[model samples]
Target: MTPRHDENTVFMTEQEAERIRNTVKIRLQRCSELAGHARETRDSKDAIRQATGASLMADMGAADPDSAQTKTQRGTLPVIAVGQPYPPCMLPLRDLQPMKLSNLRMDTHHRGRRLAVKRASPVVTLVARSWTMVFDEEEGGEIERLEVCLHKTRHGQDILESASVFVIKEPYFTLTDQGEATLRIDHPSDLVVCQDETANDILASLNEAKDDVDGVTAAAEKFARACKDHGNAALEKQNLPLAHAKYTEGLKVARQNIVSKSNPDLARDLSRNRAHVNLLLNQLDEAKADAKASLTGRQDQRSRELDSKAYFRAGCAAYNLGAYQEAKAFFEEQRKLTPGNEAASAYLRKIETRLHEQENGAFNFQKIRAGLSRSRPRADAASFVGGTEVRESRLPGRGRGRGLFATRDVAAGEVVLCEKAFCVVWGHEMEALTAMTYDVRDGGIRASPVGLTRSVVQKLLGNPSQVKRVMDLYGDYQGGGNDNVPTKMRPAEEEGPVVVDVFRVHGIVSRNAFGPGGDENGVGSSSSASAGLWVRAAYANHSCVPNAEKEYAGDLLVLRATQPIAAGDEILHAYHDGSSGDYSARRRALMTTWGFECDCALCAAEAADDPAVLKRRKELAEEADAFVGREHWAGAKRVAVARAKRLARDIEGTYDGERYEGLPRLAARTILEWLALAGQRR
Candidate 1:
């Protein structure tokens, strides 16, 4: 009897998978033809039009075995695998690849907007993930087979998902199939899925919700005017939550209605206020989204995508979603958008630390609650990252420069790579300088780590001309608590968009932060205690054995993502990596850059490596962390240096390399120790 192709019979593999290491060879030659033809089409909307862009991605897609199909049915895909494809400990993507063969630098500065690429793991590995085609050698003609299994979720949701299939003629190059079959996720509770049908209404509601931006000042004045008469009235006696709700509603109105083309100040304020209100209500994700929206006014194709706010918002959303990987990605994107945004990157690093704590059973709710008072669970300074102040920088996309672009989907644990403007030296001794010359509201001030000049620090001693600079830093010039406005006029309780040659932020501490100070080769200085305080440290992303390391001397922070960063990968340090080295996510993140499969040695070793190895690695990590937690600076530094040396030696291939050991792990250990000490001092 002949067997049917339905669920009745199991599909058996007739031959071993044909692994192809030379995926790009055939496609590379074809790319020349595709590129020439792509130029003739002249359209950005379609993927097939591009010879290299989507064309290359398509070529690679054709080789995969999974057959992604568009199902018309409302059924959802069942859980193919639990959690992630691989466990956090066994992330196959973290393995670092060889140095970039391309000398291309996507200068996003011309775009004047924030841009990011997929950050790669600094650690190199040997195990490889090869794409292979396994087909039946027998069964006469084309045989149908049943293999995949399914399940039903809580709400009687049956996820009938099927995998996609394609011929594996190459490894990385995907050919356009135009059609295929795969699983579908019917996010039953997704906002985009449900409210999309009424986009107009959704937008209208959003607009109405943002009306406060235009009238908030007037409303505040009215409240102030009526205060004398209504001081003892029922409105004054209203509950905190209720009154808070009213202000919250007004704040929301301001965010949606802000116009980037017209009221840049209003738009920024509204967006900022709404996010703050969200925080008051504990709606962290919503607050973050609003913050991100604030930066779009000055964005263009080439510049960092949005202001720092957008990154903070996206990062918060990813964190709340428990998509730490995604959250890290967003933060990396934020860093790329604003290389000076230390607040965002620091928070990104913090989340990594928090997750590490949790995974190691460090979820001490009581301790967390206690710590909450000292440091909020969310990453940031005393105020909501940045108060309502917004600055506008022209986007670079309008010009003819290669813009910095995101290479892959970034997650929170991942670091986003960025380029730093070279430093301008002041004196002749050639002493490496890490100082910020601020044009503060009230005075002339020079901020640096503890080692900087004392005379430079003493410049603010009773100089009459310096008063304005000093006052501006604290948000006042006329001894009044408003923006750098005129002496007689007041701000009416709401701040306006600043336009003075960068006023109100002469606080050398907030501006001109420290550089990450290193590169992909892991050649650089570790952060000094004080230098870590510079806000610029926020922009210096994490990478194991990073080309740059955020150094702290006293109060300065410096950045560096050194040479050897590939054409597509975002240079990064391990996120709060301490005890053991790069976990599973590290290797896979590197894979995200090439837009293909990864069979890095560490990832390949996951199945066979003793689980105890991972457990022991994490245990040692915790022990190492305990050193920093206890303020054992010497021990922490010792551990950090040892970790770096070991990884460096391992990279040189002198020792028996493990599944995961390299610069990434070492950097993670170093940063975690620094952060621990930093947190304790504060």
Candidate 2:
């Protein structure tokens, strides 16, 4: 059976799929012939008419794949597979002929917003091939070609370079609303660069001197130094991708020359510069490898400064990876090479604190809080790993998904989970950057998802091995596939490359990302609201009467149990501000924001309460608030205390004791606190 273009399952035969492809090719050929004649026609009026007719025929032929015109004609022809994240490990390559740019058409099914692709199974193995081409040029000043928008693309922006050859799998070709043809690649895994030995054929096609603008044919040392200088210049301008690319190009040229191996200084320097760029780009594994490569050359007085910097980069990369011991050793080595290095000394101190947290779970929350208030917060702390585990959430109405659960009995007020955010976009950064996106539902301008989304994608692309950290979390996904995500990280060469669907990342960010500031206790000032995604912490499902409460320390989310929880109990928290006890208001908020109705103990009890009784309770609570405000009046303390007691008692009477299960009454607690203060004053 052949795969269907509009669905995941196969419904057509291989012969039928071929017949449809031939039909499409014949029709497109006719359209091109008509267009060619229109260009050469002698009569001006006839040419214009012919050209318009040819365009209409093309648009009709390529009408969104789901549209009636194309669907009726195509009838489930095998297209490319899309809308799913890539496999965690690589699958064996399949032998399939490549699709060309000429055969591309508008994806009317997705309204040209995404790619239309299909997967075919050869026996039991499913294989996808790619279209190879050299990047010709970028469109205008946008810096994105053959992909969706800058923010939506994998690796963020400005990654594709002119003259670089790469393969694009499951490519989406369409004519934009403005009538320009484009090839859009939605997933980073879909585009693989052809470099090193594999890129030899493509490299041979280009002019050597023109392509080697940095003098690749010159002496190995001279060429390597030129690349280093180019990389350093790009770094200064904050073009990290270009700097890394230049350094990479230089390394390839230098490594091929035996002369460079004899005098490794230039080669080592190139690697060191690339490592620095990789570190800044959050490509931890690459940065670590580059740093190690930089260390192999002579470490005498001449190269002492460079070696020290390499050690420092290695330490930072290791620390980010949570290899505290290795990071400590790197820092210590750096200190030995250059005594009194302040940066290395600071990292050593941080490593000591991280080690304490790793072994004993002891943390200085007070110190972390102090650092969070600075204009530029430092949340470089590592997360604790063993307190809770991700398990299947056993809730009835909720679909098959994972939840965070306590691994052991947790006492009230004890830290249940402390996780550093995977990526955080500070409020100040958003404000200064002036990047804002409006939400039609909220009807207000808010912090754009681009900043936070880009940061997360950069990290994921830089270190694809860690893709599961974000991918494993629940998100706004429909029936794309099963929950059989790989449990263990695998090497790409052994299995296959992990596929990162940018759309999947965007969906996860929307459902799981949190606004970290708006209250006094959070990291930034109240006026500026920051956004972040905490991968592990996000697994906790929402409950109105949450078992755990969240607090912030820098970019870290500290979850503490508000009530004693059993070993296997699922951790839960409120997704919104639950200050208002109005049942209808709470229900509306939860349903609108999270797409779920609250079914927690409190919501269940409140759902059965009498409307009038709840209304009276709200009225009395307001009266008590007014009375508490007049406490500064002369001779009013006694009256205020008496009224507060009556109001608290009245509010208590409104709630059914068995239904509420002795949940704290928000209004009653307020009045009781005021009465206690009044008694203390007396």
Candidate 3:
């Protein structure tokens, strides 16, 4: 008999639930073999429902219907919902090993889990406690509860809710600072939420209208063609991600179907189109592979054009990766396939230029500057670099790592380096200008780390050949391995499936990226911010009184000597507007943002000054700023000019005389400039 209670209440004891389960088993056994199988499934479900209700009531500690204690009880765990059936295209979790949370270790990444939320905390950035189902036996199961947290993902907080099922890919189990066990996911791509649309795709990919080979071939071709058309439309609209996804989905269908051989034409076209998309997306390795795939299969004789486009894509990928010989061969083949191919001809010339630049430091910098003046920047311009080499820093502190040094004595105003930006993202191209909070300590909603990070990852994943160029850059990786960042650049070799941790990429971008500033020399300034990463420039260390200045022209970065420096002197530039702020303020800003304290000569000189003197100087500087900010009273220009001169003198007195002997009094320069302008007006 079912227990009776109020509308929202159900009461039953453990013994009573056990009796109901026995009755269900006995009733199921009495039926015929085929009938018994059907009865067992239904009766077993009914028994579980009753037993679960009793167990939940016990967990809630609800002894009385109207008890005050019931209202004050802890939040109850949500009952597991039977999610939509697993898709036919995917192998069920039962077929593969699902990771047991109980076996997890600290500082390790573990794989496998089909999770159902038991309960979830209010997501700050996506967190939940999920029940991991264990399908150890054919007829029974077990559950292991685990805490999961997704960090720095684009998914909204509400994506994790009660009873939502998910399949965690390469779940990284680790301990938080508070000594709590949690499965932390830093990459958004790591978690695949099992949504209805995703389920439908899996089902649709498997289904066929007719059973014959011709029928299967027709179905596959139709789906692939639709994907290609949709992808082409998206590409035309400049929706790169969507186009890549569409092409990928079409390729997935082709891969799963058995009758793909009967339709090589469809497969060939899909690969070729996807290759073109990959090239645009900066996925060079995938582009090259797809390009090669497009040419391997039987040709579509009905279609008129030669496979010159594939060769072009392959050549472009190789060219960007610094494989000039391979790129030259591919471009030559493309020209042969289609006579009068201007793009191929152009790339061949570029290859020659690149080969010449690599052999020696000679570059046609004049030609590169010509392209920089255009409204839309092109990254195809040849790089010009000489007189500077990356070497270990000779600073007092050994922790300064490496620094750039002049190969020869460099004169003031002489160009030391000019190189194209590895990747650049203009602010106008972003779909939404939503502020992303990576963390509070980093000053929140930074210039444009998100879009730039995505661009960097795509490029790295597509071209493993360029791994050595990037992997050596600094980041905040604390994992057990070498953090995948080599101290020295690794030699160029064939690498398989590079594992890029997005968190590491975020850290690197935060440390080295520059935003648009007022002038070419104003790197890391906040004016009209657009984020770009310049590979060679990242090696230079920071200094308040920098020896070098940076200037940007389109996607190109040119470094010039601000003062004459002998060979072996380390090159440095201001990471921010380090000239305006006082010593303490500058040090504080650097510490908070970059997690480092400045110990340069200028900083050390200012650090030795009397605190009272520094404080007075700061006050006078503020007064001068306030005086010049608004129009003064009639005939008060003389008074303002006098105050500005006095403030500039006070600020100059705060700097150390001996240590800062040759360095410019940068802190006082602004006030002095204002004073000079005021005198001119008088």
Candidate 4:
């Protein structure tokens, strides 16, 4: 029998209320899955309704009149959600097998701060840092600790937390030269955290594990050596990618060792080993840089041998780069360090021959280098935009300026372009710009917006042609092309001739740079987000209803078409979040932020003073809302789907072919939610 509530109020046990909450939560989560699987309105609507009903029951504090009796009769407890409440009495570390703790506080030495505990979100630690520590639990509850380096960082961080206890299944273990064993956590999902009844025991276990710092130095040494061995093994197997991965892992481990100051030899060895791998992989510049790094500070017999190898690698990279003289010099140093080295002798001969050929006018060094440069890897458009073929075109009447156009017919959900930013200035990294300044040689007079502008100027100084390209971008400032910046307070630099290229670059950046979405991962800056300049992507004009959408993956921007675009059609992208506000709100944002009034089809129709079209859209919107308010999910879904289709038709019917494409996409999403609710009703 259903429990009765008083006329004035209802009383319920906390446990019963919790059960009801759990049931509601489960139903809601299930609804999300149903929505994902929903294909048609009828089936989806039924699922959505059940989900809605479950929510209403939970909110109203009503018992599942049938569920309670059925559950009691069946002797089954309510379904528990994953990763909630600590489990009772810690399992033996061996029984747990691989111990994985997501979001657990790992003791780290960062920036001179010893034993600093920082939250290592899966992505932040694994993907960004590429390695973490693992603890081994013994039979008597004692913990054995080892630092593990990861071969890859492609794991997701959505469910990984620092305070959660994770049970690692089927762990892979490797022993270093120092005989310390380290466990690897490769898959993000491999770490499972279950609800615990004795949370204090688990906390104690974790504390014991962290406090057992004996043999940490030896363990770290072993782990770092193991990483290098793994890399070398991968190299021997001719798996360059795996070798690179291992080497990278090893480098991270070596750098993090607290005893690193006492072990300069190991650090030098790690760098040299990675440099050798990079050379074999044809990464000439990286190889050269690494080889140079290995030679910095301290000299011993082991160091000298490593230095010889470094010189050889550097020579080979320089030879590939067509720097014959530099290559010859490095080869000579290698030959001096290791007498009778045939490879170095051979390389020296080759350099001498190349130089002789150049002197004899039989070879064009510049031409050969240019040809080599052409053979180097070209950046793929898919790297930034995904895979869309768009071309820049002038839009005369719109006052919107240059815009991207479709080169061929593009289907909905097609990736149009993937592009890396030409230059990115992260909000937090802006401080770095402040310290970067150019001063007149004699007077030390600093320019206005000194830091950031100076940094940009220095970058431009490195590449004059890039400066020209930046100059071509639109600048809102009304300064003459050759004008020198005028300084009122400066008798400092004779105030006569200060080049304003820094100011010009600043203006161009202000006008065209995009503030990309998402939190910065401390890769570039401490800021939560960054602003970047994508030279080609800058050509895409803004529209309130855009056909193409931009997504940021780190520094890369991906552009995907939301609707089918025919050949020669102008490609449009949204500059702001399109989901918020109505037509007028969108227009205001576009005008204020982008400095343009949108004349897209939706804007035009509203401006045309057509009451019938306006009234119908408003009415359809109201009908959808009314259905939702009444819990009539099926009706709401049907209305939403119809509204989306109608909007699409109106966009297609427009004479100019420009559209407010975001509306239909937003409507489609709403329909999916309604479908989930409707499916629940069934």
Query: lDDT tens digits, residues 385-468, model 2?
Result: 577889899866767378889888889999888888888877566421112222322332222344566567667767765677
Candidate 3: where are CA atoms >4 Å away?
1-96, 99-166, 170-184, 192-267, 296-305, 318-329, 345-382, 385-387, 424-455, 458-468, 480-498, 518-530, 627-646, 675-682
Per-candidate Cα lDDT values, in order, are 0.30, 0.59, 0.56, 0.47
Q: What is the TM-score (0 to 1) of candidate 1?
A: 0.20
Error of 4 at 558 (Å): 0.6
List ranges where model 1 is wrong by over 4 Å: 1-265, 297-306, 354-682
lDDT per residue (tens digit) for residues 514-545 in model 4: 65554432222211124567766777887656
lDDT of 2 at 391: 83
Estimated TM-score per prediction? 0.20, 0.67, 0.62, 0.35
Query: Candidate 1 lDDT (Cα, whole model)?
Result: 0.30
Clashing pairs in model 3, backbone N/Cα/C closer than 3 A: 285-462, 520-551
C-alpha lDDT of residue 426 in model 2: 74
What are the per-residue Cα lDDT tens digits for candidate 3 across 257-374?
4636766656677788888887876677778878877775234533324478888888987887667889999999888777688999998987898877755546566776565532
Descending-TM-score candidate ranking: 2, 3, 4, 1
Q: In model 4, which regions exceed 4 Å deviation?
A: 1-396, 427-458, 482-503, 520-529, 579-581, 609-682
Best by TM-score: 2
* CA lDDT, candidate 4, residue 219: 58
Residue 155 Cα positional deviation in candidate 4, in Å, after optimal superposition: 34
Model 2 lDDT, full chain set:
0.59
